[model samples]
Target chain A: MPIEQDYSKTENGTQPVESDNQDSNKTPTLPSFTANKSSQTVNTLWRTLITPNSPNVTPNSSYYELISFYVYHGLLVLLYFNIFIFGLITFSINRTKLWFFELAYNPSKSPSVISADISKLNKIPKRISVILNLKPEETENGGISGLISDSSEVCAWVVASGIKYLSIYEYGGELKNNIPELRRSVYKKLAVYYGTDNVPTFSIKVPHANAIYYGASDQDIDQQRYKNTSYKPILQIVLLSNVDGRATIVDLTKVMADLTTTNEISPKDITVKFIDDELKQLVGEEPDLLILFQPYLNLQSYPPWHIRLCEIYWEPDNDAVTYPVYLRALQKFSTCKVNVGK
Target chain B: MPDWMSTFPGYQQILENCTSLFASVVRTGPVPQHIGFIMDGNRRYARINQIEVKEGHNAGFESLARLLQVCYKCGVKSATIFAFSIENYKRNSFEVDWLMELAKMRFGQMIEKGDLCEKYGIKIRTLGDKSLLPRDVVECLEEAERTTANNSKAVLNVCFSYTSRHEITTTIVNILENVKKGLIEPGDITEDMITNNLYTGDQPPLDLLIRSSGVRRISDFLLWQCHQEHCDIEIIDTLWPEFGTMQMCLLLLKWSFNRTYGRKKYRGKKETKKEKEKST
Candidate 1:
């Protein structure tokens, strides 16, 4: 809800005195001489501070008139001071408007001339590294819908350029406050994806200590959804052994449906068998050369896997990552590092 | 007047009366220094022609050569075209393999013919992540760049596995590491410091960026350097192969005219006229 509008005091100057019954018999009282006694203290201090070697004036003159003259002169000075400040403010606003117009018309002009004096863009390399928490248990946000965007093409460029060393931040880290365990889990997943050995060289810790909030509960989807939410829910899997390393992810929804044969709960579920086959097809027979994980997800929420995996039980932030950024991060990661699996 | 001029409306009369006026406009325009092209839509073009994706790429390669000639004639000192991106390698294996072969074969021929250096005095330079490319393709690119290094006519930058974000970040990382190593002072790092560290260190800012195949987005081609000064343009219904000298001429003419005839003065007179009318 937006806040209610309130501008009665500013827009209109009417005092509400007669409306209330308590104030009907009360007469407005003028400020008394007692109030002026404390104000005279300020006057005495000013005179003491400025009256050193002061020119002698007629002592018989009215002190009230003298103080009134001084007050009027002070007020006059303040009026002129305010006028000067207003003029400066108007000039500044006009100058800024002119500059903004210039920037829009000639965007190619070097921004340094008009921009504030700041350090070189080189000094601070603000890097954004994206990691897709593909594990189904990780979906607190609405499936993969928030993870993919049109920037996949840019991600391709990043990979081709051989840019490694990215800042891996958990998406929506600020919403939940600071979850150290989640951060650790995020890095662990990266280590697994890039291989544990390459983790030290390829990724940097997300220095921001923050929490992302979760809005959905695990039971929001299907009551039995918890059973299949432990492992990574893959989208497309790619394997790159020759030429330029390019891989695609395998589809999961159909595979899972194909795995379920008996509509009853059983140890030998067809879904696990399907997952194995799909993983094999995507990663190939190579031991350390390929891997699979869904890039963009939607519909189903990713379950909290770290809590289940370690059995410590920690709640996952539902709003931790958006789909578009997740997709972009995967693209950027693939572009930067040559995932040499071990 | 040429036969094509007769087909036009006002141009027909202008051709008869004022011939030098057209030449004068051309001479006075500020010719672009470097013109870059983001070649798109080979697959679409291939589909339209009932051809394979490889065939579309081959057609694109041919279009590139013709475009280069037009760029040279326009007095453009440098021209860079995005031939292949790193992510493009992730497509179907057969298609990706064909593209690698195509780059090697086409670039190798251009190098062997000495056409780039001997005929046009142009120097060939390859940009982007060369390491990600096949060994054979890398070798072909290196030979081409080395052979044409001494040429002074023009610089042809073939952006193969390039991403502007990676390039900028790489430069920044290098600068950061250099500072940490005590090899350079932090204060010494300027805008030029970052620019000089980039792959195209010796080149100037792009004047015009033309994406063929009618795509509006640049797709992270040249990120940090290109926001303000460059024009990102798209041509409608034209594949890279079909884009000829005429297309390049039209684009360059429009760009040069804009640059030369750009305005800087404020529109105070119009405001004053409006105010006078409002008062009445």
Candidate 2:
């Protein structure tokens, strides 16, 4: 089978359908509506046939189960409502944490403060990836501009923490479309910290589009005090969205299958190491830590091939992209030991 | 505590009746057709209880048996458990040997006792590279499957020496081999094709993936299947040995509840904004 067929049958199988057919045959009163092609009549007829006006109640296991389920579901609904209330209360508090975190480490605060906070961690991931959600444009920190500013702020935090590689994944691929605006926003934000004279260089890459944009113009680099060598940026940022996650893998799989048919590659050659290396080349290498800014943890279809051993971090009831979350994720990655299945 | 509770008259029978009733009630609303579990923290549970590691794993097995009984009772179509990972072999040789021995002994017990598979009509399928397993373990696994070969009610996928990466790779390899054989064209290699050919091929789509020990990472168990929008990956803080059937039933109910009401914490997970709006 080339597809996952529905092998699942409920405890009640085709017996329900067979019984319904028998009911239609026996009931001469239902034939007029059954003969009618209108779905509206069929629905009412089906409903009447299924729900008898008088149910012969029996105080058996099935009867007791109904009462227990009522109580269970009633309690669950109440518990859910309670959780929603708590979520609302914590949502306001977490929103305040965003402001407090920014106030403690904003553009006005020198870059040294951020580095000091980062320096406390035992180890920080050289490569860190984050999943950012794009909220409705009506809400604050929610539209395209809000997304751009959030991206820049995270970029600033990543650079200040001295992390070299950063990947930002927006579920809808919104940031990929506004790269120029993102580059300008990040450059401005970083310049505020390091000052216009010596802003660190960074590059933004969209792996799906195979596009790269570097920060700092050639003339701006020419004015630097020390002649920068190696010609590499201090930070490398990769922009990924939903399409870049699994769609790319499917395309690669098709190509590989085609190549095999043409005798270009052997079937045995497509081993685990082969897939890993291919993914490393197609999609980027797996990041050591992934931070989700959502209130709860859901991958939202991040590239499955790359998340083999990477640690994922997310805050409960925290939705905004904040500096505190990023710093805390790094701190967690530092203290955590990735045994890599030892 | 467990021994004392079991010492009471009709304790086990009462517990079973309660679990079956709970499962039946949950089955009334919605039941996940396919479920996956990452049984973690066995070694940690062993150390915490000051027991031998072997006994911890044994307890974990007991918990699995109990949970799967509830799952099948709830009419869950297929239950996949991460019995062992390919990476598990990287552990010391002694542990690996013991784990194989434990599997062999437990599988022997399962078939002999006419346990869950026999009672619930569950087809036992060992999904992984059989070549890597010791000969005795492989034979025992085959025996279990052979005994349960004709079961049509449900399926139990025991991922003994498995990893998601390995499963995907093996699936791809098998696909390519078929293409080379001219059985199908390369164009047939769709995402569904790969998904259906994995160790979990032919089973229903995975609905719920539960990992114990609060380890957020999936540890490479069904990585491909769980990335889908519908799969709910629930991480519980309980150790594998201590995990209970009632906790699992409640988790299933929570998943159904969230799916029905579209809980915000669980939103943007299964449905995108536009799709949710369209559905409303």
Candidate 3:
């Protein structure tokens, strides 16, 4: 029952005092007259019970009123029961999903203890992207080689987990010269895990299911445009500065301005469709999951247009990237309800 | 009628007492000056309840009313809600029409003299491209804005037919036009100049952003503002209609805690750096 109309106004306000005894004392005590008055009172009571908000109607004054009370209260109880049941079902489902996730990816356990069985997990995201913040402090601990080894380990785990696409972005460093070495190491690690024949083959002639590197230069982007071969289970290593330089909204603004001038169209006529097409040609499809290997939730100059609807998972400790942590991020992404503002 | 009822005055009194107690507890924390909401999950709520989409939107409106009242009591000054978006037009015509009708009705209520606007002294402003909306709906929204023009207690910014990308693009176009007209030099186009051209330029930077429906994404709503301010984002699992006062209070408490202790370390460093620069 709605709370607004649950109670009668008379219940909150003062009720008028009844003068039944005084009226009876002043009138003659005739049995026939008293019988008729009693019948009239019963009729009026029945009328009030049948019609809501009737003038001179006092609720809960008779047996009919008691029945109505039970009806209303019973409906209210049932409504509450429905709400309680719905809440319980939702809670148990969420609890079960979380329990399953924790069972598979136990954070308390060491990285070796958590096995990488992609089939056993509840869900695996098709595309997984990780942003590694190679700040001075991070590289100072074990040098650039340590960062590269950590990224390679992450890639090996991603391949082992059967993710179709993996992307690794390194921020705060000039890594253009080291791309070949990093790619070779990642390929070697994958070969060790999946054997030589099972490892993804790399070829500069074509965009194959292999490790590819993109640098922070327009030439790299132009080179990518020519190699349009579709490859599954490909690993893309991108420098964060490269994506930022190429895929920033500022670039979109430039494109919009040029289009407005060249095409002789109003700027207001430009929509996301035009911008999206340009972005798709620049940056590939948005990743299903974005994992930030940072101590805090910072984008680290990530391109904004690409991640509008991307699910972001952050590792707060900036700890070594582990297979279990990667799996857990994928699981979290799968459970998320992408409402899309519908 | 009942023995316990005899001891207590009424349920309303008990409710008021409890509300005041909750308010006092919330008063201990720092309230945000501006908060943004991505109101999501209405259609899902309707699907779960097996009700019509229109009824789901109505329930969402009820929740919005309750949330606004709670925010007012909690001392929140300004709130921007993602009520409608440009992408929403892609939905089926029936749903789009229903939503427009709902907006019209709600705005009509706001335009009426003695509604929540009068009671809470809320200044309502529709922030978006109005040309795309129905004429009657736009009229109602304008009338509501005109009616509550002088309100100073609180501000409600309804992002109807709005998208952050479009807003940014529009602002950029405005800047380019100004430069072309020689009203402003191209070199003088600073961050502040672009910001002042935004629909929410006069409003305070967002302190917190809350998205309901378990989705962990910004959905192109206030992307630039949130990214610029580094606003704390909280994604709640509950649908928009089910996001009640208690949930809002919990989110506010979390925001207050983060503001007081979490981000202060980095903020302090930045402030000191600015101070040293000024001294030099």
Candidate 4:
């Protein structure tokens, strides 16, 4: 007597394998047919004529099923094509909108355009420092006036955009003597942009959103001197070279050596904190964003200790300082996630 | 004979001419005091080429030998290569063993040919944890270092089983020990002191850092020296085995341009006045 076969396994294996093989073979055929037929009517005819055999399918029902399958698949293809086209159209529209916005509001493109969106300015960094490369002959060939105009425009934008604090540093020692004239130029430009009534006054003592100029001799190396007053939201103009003329590190080293010789203090106790205390006396506070108006990332000896964590922004090929480029740099800085060596 | 000249007999004269030309061209710009290399993608290069892993490592070594010669010609005082990292020890045992064997063989070859180091005056110093390495490998490294101890024309730093964090931690521990011993007081520590105590204390701070295989991360190499300094980093898409002197020269040219034109305006007034007088 013949033993009963395991029909369940046979059915499960053979049915799926056969169906899968058929599906694998038929899928490519459909696409090839559609590609060769070219016209919609021929595709319908081809689908109807090439109805593959199914065990349970009758001629009449299979014909209707095949028609429905073609109809549904054609609808899906149309839907996907429409979606892709719509996506492209929307992307182009959004890009054009952004381009138009940039063209109209970019101060670099048209220096006279002072109008900028306050919402966009809300994202500006709270503390922004600009390091300008100032040459000795900056006064010649309209460079000084051009700088004054750029400074005024930048200051006006800062005020209008509601930025809290702005610091302008002349990287070389040449511009140190002309801080007063530069400050006056900036004040005049702000007045012209915001009208005399709204323009913030230039003050040396009061804690308000005002322009304060610091020449090399004026920068007192006493941290206690700035402790009492509130460092209010203000524009600070610093006419100092990138080089630390005071040689703070060298002096600190000397101080440490002297302390080690006399008091017998351990040298390892002179940590970054002790150095930071001296640095605080040198540069008041570390800037959140440092913008370099140069072609490359040569810090020009910006106080090394202070800029350890500062985010630096500089364009490689483009050296022309424009208000729009400055704004873009600020925008880029706002999006940066600073990893402070943690 | 130089290492490359022995390796490639037909191209000896061409290589010498190219070396001389590069030497002349490099003198026009400021040479980087120290250059660091993050060698990456040897295994990937092997995988792509369908070659034995050992062959890939040998190719990388060949490229490194050529690069060292170019760096010496360019007047680069010190060159550091991340030969094997602490993290690299986690790779498969087969690959790790192959790398270890390859390193031993290369160091042994260098030791055998004493004239190569003598000709170039290259002081080879391995920077890493010595205890983690095998006995023979460490012996080879020690031998190479001992033989090249006096050569000072150029320095080669092979970071084997090294990590920047480990280096920093080790330096700190040494400093603490000195403080405990009263050999150095805690209050005397400065940036320069810390630099002098580091593994690269005798060498200048890294001026240019080049990473191969298109990876942008520093991969924990030279953290202390590169962090606060103006060290320029160049990431190239080529694999370590494919990197050559031409790629290094291109990077050097860019860095030299940045140094010359980028910071020239910020020079002190005295220097500018002297230039003006010379022009007049």
Candidate 5:
């Protein structure tokens, strides 16, 4: 482990910031904030610096994935330098695309104005899933607070746009640990958009952690009329990370394998529907649209089963959680036609 | 009588040679050992071009052959094409039947030609439940596999009548069958066990997955293999029929570029500061 840390330190410059951010997120308090809009502007830089973005090559899911993950990545460092010009040209092309999108979608547009733009769209996704990445703390609106605010910002937009369910996936699962702060942040953001008196109720679900949090406090007399019809919240939010994706499936397979040995379940019992229902219970239903707020189209190990038939939207060379990308994704979703296997 | 490029006798050979030179240059960088293709948008291409659906499929098959040759030239070890899906069975009966006929015809052609197989030393494998296929189609696929079985170089995974869920499910069933026979224990079922048990398990773990016509969805193809960080899913705007060898080569080149300088930018993020402190 010590050697691994030393190796990481020498290998990646972002190791220091990554470890520092981890310590801050483990605590459950909100620090004072001062916004710096200039640096926080969503840019293509700094995305590649994130570490442990790959699955842990631990002994858990041991040999095959572990061996290949390293083997394939290890080959990248061979550095033939033959395709250097080709690489440079392709690299510049990607950044140019990001610049084009920046011009198209102005980041300075306020949330309500973007909401109106979203409202003008002919259709919207009922269930929307987003993949969020955490930036280093040195930048404004980066790290833990940035993740919470980003989640809250999306929640507020979805609520305004009348979307029912939203799943926010951060690779590290840091938001899962800070549910209360996330709830507080989300509620505050909702109040900003919907006004405090008319704030709609919502719930935050962390399926992996087996916890559900409500936006409205129980002691609040303003929420007393909603007791009998508690079946549905206006907004249903689920937080997910890499753990809930493949690792969950690996654990389920182990369970099924164990059950087969005990004669509790037969080999034939592991059917498509059986695994589907089981995974649906473990991770929520497949979203109608999966939006990745990354520079490129990488799943970053999203729950694989749920991605089937789900339309994915991501801007090229863009990696910030902003209203323009979200609004554009909704527009894209509205234009898409999902004819299952037709 | 001839395609426009082929109208010029020397044009075809020169183009291929130049492409091979370009491919060799790109191949000098990191190359993904295994590549997967969803091959979407054939029907759309047919609709747009006002061609018969079968013709669009034929065009797609030609494109795939050319692309596969290019991939071999670029030094990829194996390639998986989602030729047919279990859910694709839901399409109209006529189309399904024609698709099956297409598979049979294509597999038979590959075997009969014997040139591509001999040239590339390609081993052909059909992944999915063979029980679902018609007996005649099964026999053709089997014959193709058998003839190419001894080829020790590369593999072409034809995912016919396959879905990732079905593959994982059946793999579990096979594992349990072993367990029932006392050859394996339930406790031994790690992820690698599940991985190795799948039909394409012996092939390299998918490095790059490509889908055409700009639909950014996995569509239940290689869901297990592609979820990890090692795999990159590229959704191109070109329809399958219109997808060309040059464009496909560009995609492969993009993958190599990203793996080399693009993504590796993160690997040395703080190395300068760390090295300075160590030197002091």
Candidate 6:
């Protein structure tokens, strides 16, 4: 079948349907053939050649049958080939078309919002004991002013970041009994978005006396604070029983020394495998990021886990800064590439 | 020993407990491949020491250098450290200028000596908003990264002015653009696909996340990737300048022990004759 094209309209705007076959007056082009008569085989094969004026039915009916067979088979082969090529072209074009559309629209817009179900998953899966530094003298406000501000900011930040599971360390006095005030403030901000049922706050209390606040706290008393603070049931927290009540680099230096002697491995010889092999067994796999609490930044007293982590320090200075710092740390996870030694 | 370290009688016990915990953990399962650190205590360290704040940062850098060696010694293949964050730019101009100078000098010295990369086969990579940094600092970082790129032994990621949220957004933009270009299928996009498109695509997942300054929070580091329920090792109450390999080992050991124990329990349950009969 021939594809149709509009050719009936004249410059005068008159239109009519016309037949396309108008080649009857023209001579047809034919393939040329040559033959040599020097061979006896050719000479004996035929005495004369038959010629026809046109390909019309004539006396040679047998010749017509052979010609028809070749024509039919040739047309069938051409039709099959055209069909195969067309199918391939269609498939290729469809893929190209889909790609064009996908490129025009951004997929990030289609990102699924974090679901509310995430809150239901926030059961106290892990018992984490936070060491609430109550020494008002040590902490800028004797753990009152700075404590509330810092704790509120920290808790709010964590809650805003979608962390619903935590066992906050509570100082038994006014803070423990009136803890609902802090909880209400945090949850009010949190529950507005996440809903109260999802962001359920949980707390743990430690009995602390004000007499200890007046510089009369013994080492045993301080140690008790430390021991009581670790995430319990599964994890434990031990506070530093010291006058300064700070975990410092000096503490870390000591730990490093002990590790060198006990494991007979120097810090200089550590490897990713050594850390990974151990961590994979414990946590199963690695986390994408790590945040550490810097109470005083005493390297000696820092948590032992900083060894295999990218530590983020969360020490609030007098400036009371937050947000942008957290955002910046979050950005690092994406921009930072593992220096693949090419 | 330093006065602070020497004075602590519990230091030895903590070290012993840490080692045993780590050893036991490792005996159980696999550990992290590449560990990244957000070193966050130069100013506080300085304030405590009553020294110039710059000196505290310089000391922090030294601590990072030592920590790298420790990571290598402990068999960690890659370690990324957050030397500077975008928020640090809010500091006084002079301090920021000094930090840039220190970074340039440190990178220059490392490249010149060829010792850091040559001996340890360390490849240095940087992550952050490069546009915000001084041109010279960016140039030095690029050079450092390029020079160490061929080293195969270990990788060192230096995140300067980095933020995890920006990274995620950037990846989203990239994915969207790629999809538009017909280079990828939109429906085929998944979490792993996003991970592959991230700046740290080549790096492995963070095995253990440790933050310094003894404050408990991720502070917006790796929000998307770390959101998975079971994929984290979070430890609060550590500072960047103060952390060491012993800490790394302890975390690793704990991770390993958990895996090994879980696997053992699983195998024991699977191989029980009664269980097999019940299944039949």
lDDT of 2 by residue, B1-280 (tens): 3668778999889988877656645555567899999999899999999999889999999999989988888779999999988999899888889999989988887776567778889888998988998888898999999998999999999999999989888888888788889997877667778888888879999999999988778788888898766787888999999998768877877776667576464334334666887989
lDDT of 4 by residue, B202-243 (tens): 998889888788644466677666644378767688999989
Give one digit per residue, the lDDT tens place, for model 5 in B1-280: 1357567878878878877666545544667899999999998999999999999999999989888888987788999999988888899999999999999989988766556777788999989878888999899999999999998789999998899988888887888788877898766767788788888889899999999998878888998899887898888898998888778777886787777555632223235546877999
Query: What ranking of all candidate models by lDDT puts the best one first?
Result: 2, 5, 3, 4, 6, 1
lDDT for each of the candidates?
0.46, 0.79, 0.65, 0.63, 0.78, 0.48
Query: Compared to the true structure, candidate 6 yields what TM-score?
Result: 0.42
DockQ of each: 0.01, 0.41, 0.08, 0.02, 0.27, 0.01
**Second chain TM-score, each model:** 0.82, 0.91, 0.88, 0.88, 0.91, 0.80
Q: Which residue pairs of candidate 3 clash?
A: none
Per-candidate Cα RMSD to the true structure, in Å, reads 28.8, 6.6, 18.7, 26.3, 15.9, 30.2
* DockQ-derived CAPRI band for the predicted complex in model 4: incorrect
Candidate 4 vs 5: which has more lDDT:
5
Give the candidate order by descending DockQ.
Answer: 2, 5, 3, 4, 6, 1
In model 2, pairs of residues that clash are none
Per-residue CA lDDT of candidate 3, range B1-280, in tens? Answer: 2337537668647755655445544544466778999988888899999999899999999989878877777678899999999889988899999999999899888657778888779999999989999888888889889888999999999999998877877777776665445576544555566567788888877878888987777888887677542577777889999998768866776566555445422223434555888999
Over A160-219, each residue of candidate 3 has an lDDT whose tens digit, in order, gives: 565656656554433444666665666666666667656653321111112344322225
Candidate 3, superposed: residue stretches over 4 Å from native: A1-116, A119-127, A133-147, A161-188, A195-233, A241-247, A251-269, A281-284, A293-301, A314-320, A332-342, B1-29, B190-192, B263-280
lDDT (0-100) at residue B71 of candidate 5? 90
Output the number of the lDDT-best candidate.
2
Best by TM-score: 2
In the range A245-326, model 1's lDDT, one tens digit per residue, is 0111112222222222222322133232343354334432212111112211110111111001110101111223322222
Clash pairs for candidate 4: A266-B185, A266-B186, A266-B187, A267-B185, A267-B186, A267-B187, A267-B188, A267-B189, A268-B186, A269-B186
Residue A268 displacement in candidate 2 (angstroms): 1.8
**Candidate 6 residue A235 C-alpha distance from true site, Å:** 32
